[model samples]
Target chain A: MNGPYVAVIGAGQATAEQERVAERVGELLAEAGAVLVSGGRGGVMLASCRGAHRRGGLTLGLLPGPDRAEGNPFLTVTVPTGMGELRNGLVARTADGVIAVGGGWGTLSEIGFAMRLGRPLIAVGSWTVEGPAREPSYPTADTAEAAVSWVLRQLG
Target chain B: MNGPYVAVIGAGQATAEQERVAERVGELLAEAGAVLVSGGRGGVMLASCRGAHRRGGLTLGLLPGPDRAEGNPFLTVTVPTGMGELRNGLVARTADGVIAVGGGWGTLSEIGFAMRLGRPLIAVGSWTVEGPAREPSYPTADTAEAAVSWVLRQLG
Candidate 1:
């Protein structure tokens, strides 16, 4: 089923735990019949794409470079942005919601853009962003199960 | 003097202290006879552009959208990329060096891209990037004076 398409933003180079969480998150989302979207590089992005693809779920990668060669091996469909990492904004902005795993600045930038766009942002072992006291900065979850469930709830 | 062009990446929604640092960085870079480049939006980018313009230094803003209206007030020239944040890569890649002030994720992503391309990255109260132990993740500067000096030294 072509349900809510969610984007997962993380670093191309990630720690083992981060990669593990990303794969689990992707698997859960695919099992739920959700379409997967990622930066289409490596680390969490690659893991998510692979998880979705293996489960027969549709996957899309919004690649930054002009060529698809830079994309990860798991992407089912790659859209060459030729924009570079600024494509982070496009990945987050176009998604219905976002799941941020352990990441570096690139992931943070995507989070910033998603937050600014008022998209549903769920951080799983990711950055702790604090905003004004009155405003909401988004939510954080402890595990992949919690993150994917939250995304589904948001789509529902 | 057209000595060099340095990019300053930081948060669009910045604190007074962050903005002050960014402005000072711009001023110092301009005083050194170097051109300033930024995202050309609000917060630190706008502050930097303003500082450069007030100092009679050339400033370029790589704006995201198709129009120049989104650019900061002090920009001498705004090149609309229409590539959205993807222009961040262009800004970082084209600059002689990058000075990162207090910023959010967008700034972080630029840092990531710049580092991957082996551009000298100077962090001023910004991200703590970690890479291979043998390679310098990036250098951190305590003040705008130090940051600008470092960029100049790199160019020299």
Candidate 2:
């Protein structure tokens, strides 16, 4: 059985932190016995996969197009949603919780979708602050260890 | 006047790379005198905004919820789309070209939306790989420079 599933959304076009963050997130998800989900690319998503794989956690990459291989190597389950960017909402909505790292337009869309769908999100590490009526904004942690710890508290 | 209006979509969470990559991309856009569009939170979008602002570029953040102030500090223009996650497609389609950085579900959705809408996307870093004619795949890139360069070539 899956422990907990979390969806991570961010920029694929990034090079430095994007990739590093994804890898760290992936590792955290694995260690936490959680499944990591991403758009299935490089940078943040790939980094997430690397983290998950290193810890032997399950990783899922939802592809925007027909090809499944477009996902990162760490993905254990790859869902090819031939939907296109329209699927961004679906992906965000499908997750139990979400985390927004540094983002672009794509990441913002997911944040919007998650909020609209009323899912719990942990905006950590200099991300956005939560507004009123939603869950209280958790502490912003710089390292993945701190971020994952916050996620566990929220899940609990 | 704007050179070419483009939208960047990806995760909002942060890692070490977020600031640098966002700044670099913003610099490039500013050099071209283009308007930078994003989800308007933190991480890459904020970095992008900071970069654009430094060079006196027009930065726009398409916010999801009601308050535009919830956007990044660097945004010169903030469009509060009460549309929520569904509006992600609008952001994707709104741009002439879409760029992907390190991202998750929301980014994938944008890519999916773009693909379905037949829009152009240039993926960089490891976030994901986008091709107009095929299904979406996530390919990894080690650096932001490589990802951005690949995107430029793909756009050409």
Best by lDDT: 1
> What are the per-residue Cα lDDT tens digits for candidate 1 across B1-156?
458889999888888887898899888888888878888999999888878877888898999899988888899888998977767777887788899887765676577667656678798777654322223457888888999999899988
- lDDT of each residue in A112-136, candidate 2, tens digit only: 5675566666654323422212334
User: Which residue runs does candidate 2 get wrong by more than 4 Å?
Assistant: A124-139, B1-156
DockQ, 0 to 1 scale, candidate 2: 0.07
RMSD of 1: 3.8
- For each candidate, the DockQ is 0.21, 0.07
Give the TM-scores of the predictions, in the order they appear: 0.80, 0.50
- Reference interface contacts recovered per candidate: 0.17, 0.11
The single-chain TM-score for chain B of candidate 1 is 0.94
Scored by TM-score, the top model is 1
Q: Give the least accurate 10-residue stretch of model 1 chain A, judged by summed lDDT.
A: A128-137
